[model samples]
Every structure is written in C-alpha cells, then in structure tokens.
Target: MEVKSNLLIQMDILGLIQANILTPVVLFFLLGLVAARIKSDLKMPDAISEFLPIYLLAAIGLHGGLEMRNTGFDSMLIPMLTAIGLSLVFTLNHYQILRRLGKFNIFDSYALASTYGAVGAVTFSVGLSFLKNQDVASEGYLTAVLAVLEPVSFILAIFLTNLAVSKQIKSKKKSLSSDLGNNEKILGMVDQSKTNLSGVLRESITGKAIIVLLGSIIIGYAIGDKGFESISIVFDGLFTGAIAIFLLEMGIIAGQRLDDIKKVGVFLVIFSILIPTFNGIIGVFVATALGLSLGGAVMFGLLMASASFIAAPAVLRHAIPQAKPSLYITSALGVTFPYNIIILLPIMFSVSSIVHNVDGSINLFNYFGIDL
Candidate 1:
C-alpha cells in the first residue's frame, strides 16, 4: 500500500505540472520572457507598465473583500492571526540568514528579508487556479490572509533597516566628528533620521497598497452579499485578465535583469529557492493543524512559498536605496515565482495530502482510545 501510494503521488504531481505549465497566463509570461531574451525591440508602454501593478493589486483586494463578505470574519480569526504572525517570523528568519550566513550588510539583508517574506499575488492567483482545476474547495477567507500579510513584512523590514542604518551612523559620529569637524551636524542628522522613520512608518501603514487592500476588505465585510453583488461583476469579471497583464509585465521586468544573475551570486540563488520551500512546508503544517481543508492547506503553503516582486520591492526601494533592485526583483519574479508555480506547488500539495492521511490515522486512533 505504501508503494502504491508513492506511485500515485508521483503521477498526480506530474499531472499538476502539465496542467499549470500549459495555461494561457503562463504561456503569455513565457512569451514576454522570450521577447526579452531575443532583444526583440519589445517595449511595454511606460504608462502601462507603471499602471498595471496598482490596478491588479487593487482588483485583487476588491475581490478578496467581496469573498470575505461571503464568508464572515468570526470563524477565520484564528487562521488570519496565525498567518500574520508566522509571516512576520518568516521574514525575521530570512533576515537573520542574510545577515549572518550571507554576510550581507544590514540594509541589503533587511531588503531581501522584505522580498522573501511578502507573498506574491500572481503566484497566489496561479495557486487558486490550480485548486480550481483540481476541483478542491478552500476557505474563502484565505483572501484576507493574502491582503494583510504583504504589509506586515513591509512594515517590519522598513523599521529594522532604518534602525540598523541609524545605529551605524551613530557609531561613526565620534570617530568622524573630529575628522569632519561637524559634531552638531551629526546630531542634526540623527534627528532627521528619526523624523524620517516616523514618516515611513506612517506611509507604510496608510500606503496606497495598504489602503486599497484593507479598505476594500472592510467595505466588503460591512456590505455583505447584496451590496457587493451590485458591483461584483466589475471586480470579478476582470480579475483573470488583469492578472495576466500583471504577469506579462512581471516577466518583462524580470527578463531585463537576467544579466544580473552573476551579481546575485550563488548564495542568493540558493537561498531564494530553499527558504520558500521550508516556509511553505511550515505553512502546510500550520494550516492542517488549524484544521483547514486540503485546499486551504495548499493555499497556505503556496502563499508562504511565494516571494513578492511588487509591494516588497516598492517598500525596500524607498527604505533601503543602497540595496540593488535587480537582485531582489529578478530573484523573486524570475527564479522564485516560476519555481513555485511549476515545481513547488505540486510538491506542497503532495506533502499536504500525506499530512492529511497521517492525521486521519491519528484521529482514528484517538477515536478508538488506543495508546501504544
């Protein structure tokens, strides 16, 4: 029976890859990539490129908010809080690895931390599609989990990076003060950093991304079915098309940095792949232990495994300008996103299934009042 189970898992995994890889959205993304590789004079309009990310994110938020209406907030409170806490912990875990193992400077370490910790919207879209294709049902409130997790990592990364940068500046003051003859100036600069950090914290909390996502969620929750039904078609009907446009733009952005692979080094290349897989397995365990269904378990794993190319990059660019943009963006969109959608998602689903089966046996044992 074990041998039979292993073989069936392998076959199902193969089917998942085949189905996800052949989808129109993935194909369009590939087309953009090939265009970039060939240097085909392919240029997305600057306006379109800038506009797509915001639109797609807002659309996702609105839809997620509507879903939250369909499913109330009461039952999902535990899973939502668990996801947020685990997400922040996940970010810190990677930040430490970047600082200690990779020997990255504090700014770069925190920036990479934000990138890895934040979830990918497009990746989640692909995961949702995967679940639908499999005809698996997940908790609707997983949508709220998606909206909240991105900003938690964003806020934490900014604060940590700013703290590190400020400490280093203070450490330099006594030594550099005499050489530069500017002790008073140094004190003034320190004051500026504090004010700046406060402003950044304020911006992050009320940023367009946060406002649009969280605001939509609240509105969706408050309005419930009838009110949302009035506008659901606008939000829901255009979601997939918007996601496709988003991915196409993402591929173009990623492909532009393909030349930066050497700059990213062997360490980041390996770190991006391994960390997500580890976090994803942890997510699967959390969801299952929380008693989510198989589909919800898969969504949790997928969210954990996805690296953010959008919000994380936006926040890090402003907060840690010293860190190289090409490295994080390329690593997330080019390497990590593709890896999750094609390979890791299927593997995570398989693991979730095994966990469910094992858990079932344990539940049965408890039912029978049998102890070893």
Candidate 2:
C-alpha cells in the first residue's frame, strides 16, 4: 500500500505542477523571458518596476498577517519556533556547504548561502496557490512563518561571513599574538569588532526588503480581519496581477543574467539544487513533529526549498558588496527558485502525503484494527 500510494502521489503532483504552470502569473514570466531573449524591447518602466515588488510583498504579507490574526500565536508557538530555528540552521549550514563544496570565498559563499537560506515570499505565495488549487488545506499561520523567515538567512549568513573573516585574520596572522605589535593587535580588535552580532542584526533587518516585508506583516496584523477586508479591493483583488508583473520583471532579469550560468558552473548548480532538498527534508520532519496538516508540511518544505532573490539581493547589496550579484542572483532566481517551483514543490507534497497517510493508517490499525 505504501509503495502504491507513493507512486500515485508522484503522478498526482506532476499533474498539479503541469496544470499550474499555465497560469497567467507563470505565463507572464515566461513571456518576459522570451521577449528579453529575442530583444523585443519589453521593459517595465523604472518607476512601475520599483513599485511592483512593494505591492506584491505587501499583498502577500497582508494575507499572511490576516491569517495570523485568524490564528493566535499561543497555539502556534512550537511550530513557529521550529520554523524559525530550522531556517537559521539552514542558513548557517548553507554557508558551510558553499564554502566546502563550492570553494566560494567567505563573502560570496555567505552571500549565496543567505540567498538560499532565506525563504522566497513569491515562491511561498505560489506554493499556497498550488495548495489552494488542489483544495488541500494548510494552516494559516504558515504565512507568518514566511514573514519571520525573510531576514533570517541574511543575518545568519552575515554572521557566518563575519566568523570566517575573523578566523582568516587569526589563521593568517597567528604570529601576531607573539609579535606583541600594538598596531597589529589594534587592527585585529577592529576586525573582530566588525563581526559583532549586533552589527549583523542591524544590517540584515534594515534592508529595504526586510523592512517592507516585516512592516507589511505588522500593518497586516494590526489591521486585523476587518481592516484587511476593507482594503481587500487593492490588496486582495489585485494581488495576482501585481505578482504577474513582478514575475515578468523577474523573468527579464533572469534572462539578462543567463550568460552568467558559466560562472555558476556544474558544482555550484548541483549544490543549488541539492541544498534545498536537504533543508526541505529537514523541514518536513520538523513540521511533521509540529502536527501540521499534510498541506502545511508541504508548504513548510516549499518554504525551505525556496530561495530569496528579492530579499537577499536587497541586503547583500550592502552586506557583501564584494560578492558577485550574478553568482547569487542567478543561482537563486535562475537555478534554485526555478527548481523548487517546477519540481520540488510536488515532490515535497508527495512525500508529505505519504507520511501523513502512512501515519494515519498506523493510527487506524492501532485504534480500530483495520490495516487495509
């Protein structure tokens, strides 16, 4: 039964991905990419381009905020903490893997790691839509998880980078300890102070993307249901269109960055695909332990698999200016994001379904003596 069920779930998820891929939102993104490749002069006006992400993030955050208002925090404390903790772990581990496997310098590795570690709100939004389309119910509070996780990987990544930088200073200058040079010691102090956790916290949380996302979440929470419903005309009704436009912009950017694929190469590309799967499986176990519904488990895994192109870039612009934009951006949006959206979501949902069902069957047999 387990094996048969697993096979059926895989087929079902593939069907779902195929069906959802044709939506206006995804289609617009494809359109933008094609237009860019053909050089048809398709471009978002700079003013409007700047406005779209804000609108989409606000819309998505408000939705999650509304959900949080619907579901109070006391009941969600365990899973919420689980989600946040796992996200942090994923970010830190991602940096380690990037450095180990990809040999990326401290700055670039951490930057890319943060990019992967952070959840992609857009991808999460789409995952929600996927669940909705299948009429699969998920916990509303997962949106809150998305909001809280947006800045986690970036901060953790920065911390990782700082740790590495400090270590490199000590390793390369181990002699400085015996030399007793006041000048060298003073410089070392400055470097260690630069890696201070407080500084990373500030820079990571202060990025425009983080600020906007968290701010929207707060505003959404404060407004509550009644207030949100009042503004649903703009935030709710037009949310899809805003996302379509945002993705259109993203598609163009991805196309422009395609040439950088050679820079990413095989090892990093392979790393991009695997890291999400690794973290996503960990998320599954965590969510499962939290007693989330099957759909909730898949959503958790989706958030795990997804990488933040928007938030990471916004923060990394300042945090790791030395990191190549193409390396991280292209890897996140071009490789990891696409892989998660196209392939990983369904696989996650299928795995969650299997676990949920197998668990249900075990409980049934234990309680009622019916195994079939």
Candidate 3:
C-alpha cells in the first residue's frame, strides 16, 4: 500500500507537469525561447507588444469587477488586507536577506526586494489559465488582490530606499570636515533622497497599468451581467490567445537575457529560485488557512511567487537609479519568471489540492505513504 501511494504521488506530479508543458501558452513561450537561443529573427510586432498587456489587464479587471459584483465586497475585504500584509512582510524580508546575507548594497537590495515583492500580471493571468484548464473555480476578487499587491510592495520599498539613502548621506556628512567638495555632493544626494513619497503614491495610483485595470473593474461593476454579455466575446474569448502571444514575446526577451544569468552569479540565480518558492509556499498555506478554494489558493501562491519585471523596473529605474538593472531585471525576468511558470505553478497546484482536500486527511505524508 505504501509503495502504491508513493507511486500515485509521483504519477500525479508527472501528469501535472506534462499537462502544463503541452499547453499552448507554454509551447508558445518555449518557441520564443528557442527562437531567441538560436538567434532566429522572430519578433512580435511593436504595436501588438504594446497592445497585448493593456488588453489583458483590462480583461482581467473587468472580469474581476463583474465577479466582485456577484460576490460582494465583504468577501474580498479580508483577502485584500491579507495581501497587503504579505506584501509588506515579503518586501522587508527580501531586503534584509539581499543586504545582509547576499552582501549587496542598500540600493540594489531594496530594488530587488521591490521587484520580487510585487506580483506579475502576466504570471497571474497564466495561473488563471492553468486553473481554467484544470476545471478549478477561483474568486474573481483575486484580480483585485493582484492590483493591491503590486503597488503596496513597491511603495514600501521606495520608502525604505529613501530612508536608507538619507541615513547614508548623514553618515558621510559627519565623516567629512574640510572636504567642502565632497560635502556638497553629499548634500545633493540628500536632496535627491528626499523623494516625495506622496508624489510616488499618486504616480503608483495613476500609472497607466493601474488606471486601465482599476477603470476596467469599475466599468465592469457598473455594467453588470447584461453589460458584460455584450463585450464578453472580445475580453473573454481572446484572452488566452493574447496571453500566448504575450508570453512568446516574453520568452524571446528572457532568452535574450540568458547570458546575463552568468553576470548575476550563481548565488543570485539560486536566490531567485529559492526565495520565491518560500514565498509561494507561505502564500499557499495562508490562502488555505483563510478558507480559499484550491484554485484561489494556487492563484495566491502564483502571485506570491511571481516577480515583477514590468512594474518594478519602471519604478525602480527612476527611484533607485544607483541599482543595477542587470542584476534585478535578469533575476526577475530571466530566472524567476520562467521558474514560476514552468516549475512552481504545478507544484503550487498540487500543494493547494492537498491542503484543500475534502476530508482534510490528505497531506504529503499520507499521500506519499510516509509513516514518519
């Protein structure tokens, strides 16, 4: 019986991996990667590249809004709050690890923390697709959770960066007595470090991505069922195809950065994989404890696991100019993104399945027939 159970667990894991790998989304992504690796000339059109993300974001937000109308706000409140809490914790923890253990400078540490702490929209969309493939149901408000997680993590990271820069400037100022030239430079840095938090907050809220997503959600809610019916064909029908194309472009881009993986070092490569896995497991357990459905729990885990290549780079490039884009971008886009999509997604799904099992008697030990 024990051997049979272990075999069953292995078979289940293998089946999931096979199913995910064969999906159109993953296949397209792999095609793009191959194209890039071999130096093929395949490229997504510039116009389409710009258009796909907006369309995807709008579709997700609108669907979520419609779902929210059906589910009501009360059901979403706790989850949103939980997402915010997770964002803060993840950011702080990542900063400490990157700074202290990884021996990175403050700017690089905070930049990376922000990048990993924030959720990826594309990854979340793919996770939703995975759930749909598995015939799993999830909360519509999970879209709202994605929206909340991105900004909260970024804002906290930016604030922390500012504080660290200010302290570093003060320390430099004290050490310099007669070096007027150096003191002047330190003063300039101090001014820059005093970046307006309120301004960043406003920008984050009003950014194009946030605007499209939030606006679409509002439109969706206001429109109701009949209104959704009118536009469902475009938003719902084309979403998967759009994602496949988007990921194709993503794969090409990630492939271009493959060489950068060597530049980022083995330590960071390992860091990118391990940290997100830890965060993902925490997200899964938290979602289960909060009584989420298996699909919702998996989605939550994906969001936690995914690192923001888009939003984080945009913000951090301006806010933390000193941080190396090569480091953060390569880690998030080149390593973490692929790992989450190809490997972590199936693992999260399986883990969530066990946690949300009907009898609550199913677990790794019992499922694998481990007596200990």
Mind giving the per-residue lDDT tens digits that candidate 1 earns over 1-372?
A: 445445535566678677667876777777777788888777778898777656656655665666666655576889988988988999999989999999988778887888888888778877776665555666767877887786778778877766776786778785776677677677676645432566666776787766776777677777766787787676656666766676677677667777887689999989989998999999987788787767789899888888988776667777677788887887887789878877898888877766666334334223222221
Better of 2 and 3 by lDDT: 3
Q: Per-residue error at 251 for model 2, in Å?
A: 0.9
In the order shown, what is each candidate's alpha-carbon RMSD?
Answer: 4.5, 4.6, 4.4
Candidate 2, residues 1-372: lDDT per residue as tens digits?
A: 456445546566668568667877778778877877888788899999888767777776777677777776665778878787887877778777888977888788888878887888788877766675566767767777776777777777776666767776767576566667575756656474344567657766675666777788778889998887789999877877777787788788877777788788888889889999888877775676667767788888888888888777767876667788888888888888767766787778776776676444333213222221
List TM-score per model, in order: 0.84, 0.84, 0.92
lDDT (CA) for every model shown?
0.75, 0.75, 0.84
Once fitted onto the true fold, the runs of candidate 3 whose alpha carbons sit more than 4 angstroms away are 1-11, 178-182, 358-372
Best model per lDDT: 3
Ten consecutive residues with minimal summed lDDT in candidate 3? Answer: 363-372
Write the residue-wise lDDT of candidate 3 on 325-351 in tens digits: 999999999999888988899988878
Q: Higher-lDDT candidate among 1 and 3?
A: 3
Better of 2 and 3 by TM-score: 3
Residue-level error in angstroms, candidate 2, position 77: 1.6
